[model samples]
Target: MKTKICGLKSLREIEIVNKYTPDYVGFVFAGEKRKIDEEVAQTLRRELSRDIKAVGVFVNEPLERIAKMCEKNIIQLVQLHGDEDRDYINALQSEVEAPIIKVIRVQSVNQIKEALTLPCDYFLYDTYSQHSYGGEGKRFDEMILTEVYKEDLSQVREGLQKPYFIAGGLTAQSISLLDNRLKPFGVDVSSGVEISGQKDEEKVREFLLAASKVS
Candidate 1:
């Protein structure tokens, strides 16, 4: 399984990720906390390792703005975390070639089923919250996964055709707790690897090590 360390800011954090690179690192372009401006993102992107991909997290951001970021090669992937519909995605696709990751705040199995129909390259399943778009560090009910796949924790199923990443309340131990049968394409972590609102190097390393053991 792949590992994505999200909500990374500052050159110090970038240095940490460079040393122990995750498959992907995220820069928050939306929200108040953890959000970075275009200039700052560009600077950090320049320092980031080429081996690791950078993801730009946004919530209902302007298409031109996101497209521009991709055009500038500041972020390798776009993660939509708001109420953006197909038209918005279709329009954005016309402007940029970067792959889009639609985040589905899982509330019910039906919601996941519906999201599968969207025309995005990947999906990220995060816990639903009333107050925030993401980075809440709360795990959704795993029973939902069992219902969607309709299989035992040790059996694989082809129900979800698209590759996806799981987010929310994920830590090193929590990742180990994931049903080996229900493997996500990747695992996304933010607050889970943080210490007092900052990225912790030891925590990030531990999280990556745990993910490496999966699959």
Candidate 2:
């Protein structure tokens, strides 16, 4: 199973990622406590190991700006955690070479159903948040996935272009809680891996180790 560590802001966090070496690391361009500008993203990108892919988090950002970052190799993947629709995704796909991972904020099963149809490289299922797009460290009822799987397991597995990641308040224990039969493509953690409002080395390592077992 792939593992993604999102909302990274500091060089220290980048260094921690380097040590743990998750499949994906995120740079939030979207507004939040963890948001970073393009310059900082570039520096972090440079600091990141070649093996770890950089994912740029955006919310309703201009297509050109995102495309420019992709073209310049500042980010290898684009994670859209906004109100971006199919039209927006279509426009972005035409302009950039980087793969897109659309975020589906889940408050209900209907939202998951809706997200299944979006044209993107991958889908990230996260908890619904009124005040934030994601990275709020709040988890939704993971049983929603069980409901989806029960409804029509084969269809969701086959129809989805790629394996999707589960995000929002994920911890080592939470990762262990996932049903073995319904494993996600990956698991994303941000605040769960943080200690005292910052990414902690031990927590990062622990999270990665736990995720690896399931992956």
Q: Against the true structure, what is every candidate's RMSD?
A: 3.2, 1.8
Question: What are the models' TM-scores?
Answer: 0.94, 0.94
145: Cα error in model 2, Å: 1.7
Give one digit per residue, the lDDT tens place, for model 2 in 41-103.
999999999999999999999999999899889999999999999899999999998989999
lDDT of each: 0.88, 0.87
Model 1 local distance difference test score: 0.88
lDDT of 1 by residue, 133-189 (tens): 984899998777657765332222332666889998999998988866676899999
The alpha-carbon deviation from the true structure for residue 25 of candidate 2, after best TM-score superposition, in angstroms, is 0.2
How far does residue 173 in candidate 2 sit from its true spot (Å)? 2.6
Residue 133, candidate 2: Cα error in Å is 1.1
Model 1 lDDT, residue 166, Cα: 91
Model 2 segments more than 4 A misplaced: 153-158
